[model samples]
Target: MQNRLITCTLLLAALGGLSACNKNKGGKSDVTGWNYNDGKKSSGFYVAKPKDIKTGPGLVFVQGGTFTMGATQEDVMGDWNNVPRRVTINSFFIDKTEVANVHYREYLYWLENVFQDPQYEAVVKGAKPDTLVWRSELSYNEPLVEYYFRHPSYNYYPVVGVTWKQAYDFCIWRTDRVNEKELIDKGYQNQNVLKQELNGGGQDNFNTKSYLMGEYQGVPGKPKKNPLKDAQGRPRNTVKFEDGILLPDYRLPTEAEWEYAALGLINENPSPRRSEKQRGEELISNRQMYSWKNDGYDNLRATRKGNWQGAFLANFKRGNGDYMGTPGGLNDRSAYPADVNSFFPNGFGLYNMSGNVNEWVADVYRPTTNQDEDDLSPYRGNEFKTVDVSGGEGNLRDSLGRIKYVNENDSSLRNRFNYQRSYAVNFLDGDSLSSSSYGYGITTLISDKSRVIKGGSWNDMPYWLSPGTRRFLQEDQSSSTVGFRCAMTHYGAPEGAGSKHKTGNFFPTRRQKR
Candidate 1:
């Protein structure tokens, strides 16, 4: 026994030396130390340093918390759809304000310039807002129809007349633009790459997935020293995603995330000790009717002292025919949708969460989603797919220069134990014999095309201004009273360290030996 103990001690000492030697002269881990090389030849392997996550432009981090999702006030509509339920939301970054007319115009400008071909012209045109949506049969809205989006005066207003599909496409475009700019700023690529003219429109666009998969390459720039060496000790020519340089893809906020953010209940619920020890004891004080300080709907005045004292809290219809307020003393100040940042922000520092244009969320419409969804970070829509390997070179690019993906099939996923199905889009709402009994189209108006729209619009009454009040619209249909904001998943913690929440550690804790 004494001999065995001494042997173990010696082995541990050797491991300590091994760890110290694995670090390079610069104090970074050398990839070679990980024993990653195959027998074939010398290759590059990167040990990426963790990067500081910079908040994307126009975004506010919504430090997530537990809250009762659904109607906070009386269900005046009698829908019973939004039955209150407890749910926990994960922290995520969201646009501080709605996407404005100027933002949409920038997207359009890129579309027009990149996709100038006759075949792609239709694609560009489809992205344009339906200006005619502003027109009404009785009202003379001709001026609004022509000028709402194009006029400089309305440039800062939340963009409307955009379909859910169009908003989703805009998110994708924004992600690529932001990431491409990041690479350029880091000197990984040339600054003039964005300026280079391509013959096939979107075919040469910088899609994040495509670029990472080695399927797309921009204009050549000053190449960095590749860690992987060839037979002759020459550097390689590729950049891998493991370098931790790219940002995550932006998407529409899920239904639970949106509702949780809009409520911004964190300010009302104070946790003296935010550790796991006190998690269950954190108490939510007053239930909110609007995204504001008071439970009363009529209390629109700013509680804090400043120039904002007695100012309206949000932009919405006060009563029947009372859009703004009487004459000179306009209550909410605007008859139409106001500037995206006009009103006071919620507890999460997000503007117009309760009133403005109703925003589209990334949820398939289902009245029963609350009952069936997971308590933690609840969401409804998910469609599983795998990278297509049929072309032999698995990462083969299609004509559009995007990596191709196919729905997972039973034969290909034979050994997988967790998932046996190809698609999960309608996983919980399709057939009775399946996991979920809620039927789509056949028994209800809910279909794959139906998407959830949350918050209230400028045309909406006070009842509709509640954050929990949800409605549905077809994905392809545009609406003058609806708009959207983008969201990005938070990579690390639920409550970001040094943030207002001051709760749990920002990263995973190392497991203790038993």
Candidate 2:
């Protein structure tokens, strides 16, 4: 009995010594030297808190849903390109107004300041809109050609004569600027550092990917109190995308997303609950011919209350030789393209969705895209690429401070599901057996470079006002009647992360069945 008692005492003393050792090792009681609890190691990997994503500048949230993405009116041109079909579009955010001359001028100013060298100077010059687009042989439009982009009066007007490529570049530039500003505002980087870097130029500019990859170093500013800590209790300052602080890339909206946003059919199709006793059926009551609520094309005036009751709801040409009607009691109030905010906004709070200037979309034009593309978030022209990591260490930046990418190689991208391709811009357009089966340039005007343009312009008649009516233009060409808006993908729930849909249980305890 004494021997057994001594054994128990020795065992308890050994346990106490072990507990003391654990306490000495930074107060962690992990026996295996692994900070673990409940069969999971705490490796200091931070799961970021759910962040409420604020809307970006000039953007509005567009609630998305299933819609008939095609001709709401008769196919007047009989092209049959936009065949009626049901497709689902995910919720996204889009610019509230078309990019204006003021915005484009800001971009040009940045380009001129940073890229003053000959090579970049030439790039900046190439991005300039073809001002001669305004010149007409029949009419004296030289003054407009000279003053449209420069005049302060037209600063708020939608920017025109910009090619699709130029517009895309603008989106890229805007994304960087907006993200840089966000970092500055969040106290992650100093504002003075940005100014200094801008003045220095040449690979010193604040590129988002470059900064994230530790390529471009900005002067560290006052950082917010860290919510996470290292094993040694040191505060960590890295920002991850999961935190929702960084936004998705801004790009041209897909053709379907653009049309769905323009239609704003959510107004017609309300939520399921209409009243206490009556539930609204999942149905679209009215088929709209234009972006506005009205069915007729003749009535351009607003029927809603306020001083704007009789005001024009959109900007478009009424008839031949009638751009904005007579000066006295003018119909639409402008001779040429009006300010981006000129007309009343659609149900989604987006301006000039139907008229102002025809906007470029991201889709490569195809007559049968409606039939061939996936019904959910339908789009074309996807070219998969990856960051070039061949230089031993990855995340290398170019001379311009932008991260470089290369076409994803087939070997690295191949999978068991059979998606083997270096690129997918024109995937399945042709087979190895035949060349004439899917001829793009040989038989039809359509090519891989042909992008879709939507909406009508100030010079267009009422027939072009339908949101479903689409036209194609070469990606490299500019036009006096073309402008663009930007769209960003929404990350979380379809309705949104903050949505208050039904949760918990669908039935009461008494109603529950075995």
Candidate 3:
């Protein structure tokens, strides 16, 4: 037994010596992706990527879900329109109020000042106001014609007589301005980049992520270096969209988003699906029509829950044949303009969705939309930038065969699709029966057509007050009845740590129903 123990000890010692010494038989290192030299391993420790994004101001996260998009309960006789269709909508944002006269004027002011070139100047002037809307047939709106747009007093009211195309331009202009300011505030010194260039150049220099990562300071020419070095030991900027910077292409709301927001329906119940069993306390509630509930003056219903004396929530004609309000008491079209923040806000903390100047949405007009469109981000139209022929144009192909035009000016080259001009082209190519094999729906359209408007106006009757009612006009046509609002798409969950207002308490909660 003593002899065996002595042999085992000697074997163990020999193994230990082999481990200490260099034994290179094949010569390949044991480490596949790591290298250890001078004490530290070359590869860094693995880290799971960050999941939730931190959001900043300017984004209004719209909670989305399925809803009866049109009028569910009947208010008028023979009103079979706006059938309740179950559809889901993804989250997005929208401007809280209609674009006011002051805001529109700001856009016009910029356009006039910047693009002094003759070609652009002509187009801008042609799109100016149709001031004749202020002229009442029987009474005097002459004062309004002269003073409504220009007067400092009327600045807060919704801007009227602006075309749909002009409104779109304003949105684009706003995006550029907002991004430009953001870049300057971050200390980017390139004034020439923000300046108006004929084509899109030097614009790519602005990055939202690098700014958030502390790489780009607001001061000019002082971009900081990232603390964490890359594989080569050189610093690298963080990925884009890591910071909550939204590139400004804020558009008008889609018809679906508008209707859903107008309803102000939210998820009150903790239940995941609407089909899940629900308690009485879990149901989502209804929203009223007025900015506030029933008031005396314009009150259509008998009972009134609004403020004292029935003051106007918005500017409008009161009583029968009273286009203007009572004498010496601001006319129907009187009161110069009230402050933008004057009125009561709705359930979602949005002001004047109703009884403000009507707003334009991106939907093409259709009676049976709910029957078709996908619930997610319900929108109907998209006419992006046309293909530039000056560059090496790729061969355009159709399902049938390769498409070739005689010249660049050929209408086929101008538009990608060859769908029918009718409004039936609601869904994408394969999604609907009314698919576009030939042209776009708007391509063949003529007259005052394209672009849809929403919200009731100060000049409209009670029936138009519902959020679901939709109407459209040509992109170039302007009207006193029309105005607009802006919106941006939200990136994540609506309620987060960054939310300032106690969203849960201020607004009623929603629950899925069995």
Candidate 4:
């Protein structure tokens, strides 16, 4: 009886140690040998063990890997752009479909309602898509110009006539809204915010940056129990970066990331296996000419075994003067731009990758991008900026209830040499041309304002359907065939926080010593 009691006491002590290990996950600081992350006022660094990254609404994961980027077919246009090169892209999140008419309308509605004061009319106007883009001298596209964006029938169609700048602004707006909702859900923010505050001529609204910096104190007394507490149990107003609550900002995808995602080559690898014995060779079985996984079939993305078998795969012009097809048996069915989610998705469950509309990417146009870009997560367009503090204004925001920024030049930036050198590395050539208004039809049609656009449109031939095909347009210019989607960076693990057998190299977890 005495021996059993002693063993039981020892076991209880061991369990107690294990519980303490979990409670003090940061362990002790090696230098001072003091407990870290303890809920104390002095000598404590708080660290929250947050859950794994959550996939944001309307986004799909694109696992990264090495792939050949650039023209896979004959360069009949002879632009000499998109030269073949091997590059690796880091994992990221992108919209499952193009930004639809309804989504953009929601953005516009908020802008119009919030910025209603006449002084801010231009702000609302600038965000509007140029509905006039559908008009042409040769063709009578007047009806489309009047109805495409506003009409209820076309709500799900991909939004066209939006400039890259407008799309970028939309992304910023989306990030704030998403983060704001997250805080509200976590009881850090008040739910019943006032209407006047949202549209106040002088009052700023709840933005992610301003909230983090303690500028916007949201509506209080909404939730019964608030979780934001300090050491003494007083309510804390602001959330910190280390909280792991707010998600990364939404932005445009880099050229490499876009191309690699469009390819969706993960389908080439073997399916999930239980053990090493069941696992097949790790290899891509075939190369893809279009976004879909083709197996020597002309109709790559069509339904093969159903009533819709051999149906046209993507929405593109069949030939000159061939938009849809002969009356009854229509080819691809889409005359102009179809609904954003009309077609079949690729291996990544991304819809309309090669058709319906060309999507904007975050890269300055360069014919030799494949040659100039870095092998790892390559991109060209970069304007390194810091929160504008030049006038000692102290983290002030512009009229849009957002943070202002200035270029990280020698004077504005803390690290002068770093900014200029990094600019030289990626942003020099583009900035030089941009500073001079692109010389406007002077030396060349291409300019710094020109940005890379990918995928084919409703009016494009099959040549443009290939994922490797590339094109460019001015950043401020809107087009009837050009639309865009948003992307977000994957912060922690590239393969994501998956099980040992899932994301990365499979390894058995070592058992704890008995």
Name the candidate that leads on TM-score.
4
Taking the tens digit of each residue's C-alpha lDDT, what string does model 1 give over 1-514?
2233244335432331333433454433354343322223333333443333468888888877789999888888888889999998877899999999999999998888888877777788899999889888898878989899999999999999999999998998899899888777766678777876344456787887777666677864555654543434455344444445677779999999999888877667556345645643467878888887553333556766677777788888888888888887888899999999888788888999988899999998877778778899988777666667678553466654566777767587778897667765566566444465545567667777789999998899878888899999989988889999999887544555323333233456789889
- TM-scores for all predictions: 0.83, 0.85, 0.64, 0.86
Arrange candidates, best TM-score first.
Answer: 4, 2, 1, 3
* Higher-lDDT candidate of 1 and 3: 1
lDDT of the structure predicted as candidate 1 = 0.76
Please give, for residues 338-436, the per-residue lDDT of candidate 3 as tens digits.
Answer: 444555454455666765567788776554556666666666664422223242323222211112222223344545475433333344432356553
Q: Write the per-residue lDDT of candidate 4 for residues 117-223, one digit (tens) a residue.
A: 88888998899999999989999999999999999999999999999999999999899878878877876666655354456433366777666655556674434
Clashes of 4: 0
Q: Whole-model lDDT for model 4 versus the true structure?
A: 0.76
What CA RMSD would you report for each candidate?
8.3, 11.1, 15.8, 9.2
Clashing pairs in 2: none
The positional error of residue 195 in candidate 2, measured at the CA in angstroms, is 1.0
Worst 10 residues of 3 by lDDT: 397-406
Off by over 4 Å in 4: 1-37, 40-44, 194-203, 220-228, 231-235, 272-282, 296-303, 391-395, 411-419, 422-440, 498-514
Candidates 3 and 4 compared by lDDT, better number: 4
Give the alpha-carbon lDDT of every model.
Answer: 0.76, 0.76, 0.52, 0.76
Candidate 3 is scored at a TM of 0.64
